[model samples]
Target: MRVVTMLHVEGELDQSRHAAIEHAVARAAGEVAGLRRSHLGRHYPGTVGGGQYTWDVLFDGRDPAALRQAPALLELVEEGALRLDTVAFERQHLSVPEPGIRDCVKRTLLLRVLPDTPPEAVERFERDMLGMPRYIDAIRNWAFSRADPELHPTPWTHVWEQEYRELRGLQEDYMLSPYHWGLVDGWYDPESPQRIVDTNLAHVYCPAATTILGWEA
Candidate 1:
């Protein structure tokens, strides 16, 4: 299973708190029961809403309780040192199959489709979103999944994740493509009748050395 936990430092993080928090988070991750790999870092400059840092973790199984009981993590939140949002989903429908694992930039979009949306419209939204990679070649590998609301309690309904060889692949090719701005973007554009996504969405990316999209199983 793959889970993404994003955080924003709530206030000034002096050097001392910074070191302690970093160490605490590292220790917590190592102790989590099903943890396989952990990627924690500030997002690349080009993206938005991904918070200050993203803790993208992979697990052998879904152990929600164990993740919550992560040692010393609650104290940081209590101390007003960090703000967090997390979503976990493992059943991925690949829009673009991965080439292979290598050093790359990992990006994720966590969005919400309003509960009142009719079923047919939601289906169309999903289809249009999946269609994006067909025209934007920079999206080397991609998966889009609907998150289970029971697991996270966050309103987010879907997760869109992908990897690019470099930032320019996303910044220039993907962002600048006609399919993005002209075609698939309507689902996210508030002014458009096709919009299904909540305006408050997370667009975050970070440097990754291994494939976080999970090709193994």
Candidate 2:
């Protein structure tokens, strides 16, 4: 039972507050059962998508109820440090070769399907998304979800996540993969108002330390 918690951060923050935020998150990580990995990342400035900073918490064999009660999460809420826009939890949906415990890069996408899109079409789109890894070998790990309104009441309905060994692979291999340009791109049109995608890439951080730094590799 893998669980991921995505926090959409808001409110004024300075360097001091930022450090405190990370500390709170780390404190929560220690208190939560099954929370083996955690990442607190700030999106690159001027990016066209995603939250300003995302707190990605990964838990194994933990329930969503327990996750909400995480000490760090509770502390943030109680202290008014976080103005959460969205909170989503998803289990592992697609299987790929595990990237193991090493440092890697990750891309997270928040998607919203047009209201006018047919239900059957939406279902088909999901099937195609799940099959993406078969065609793009650059993706080292992947997981995603079409949010359940009852559990995840966020405006976005779909969440896509993937890991890569290096950013170059993401750009040269995954982005240029025939499967992406030929098949996936056809399904998504930037010009179309019917669909929305907000993507952000970040260095992967585990319990032990921050990993996958530097852009040279």
Q: Please list the C-alpha lDDT of all candidates, in the order they appear.
A: 0.79, 0.59
Extract clashing residue pairs from model 2: none
Tens digits of lDDT, candidate 1, 94-141: 743665658888888899998799999999988888888888888988
For each candidate, what TM-score against the reference? 0.90, 0.70
- Clash totals, every prediction: 0, 0
Note the residue pairs that clash in candidate 1.
none
Model 2 agreement with the true structure over 148-209: per-residue lDDT tens digits: 55554566667677777766666688779887776666557665443333332322222212
TM-score, cand. 1? 0.90
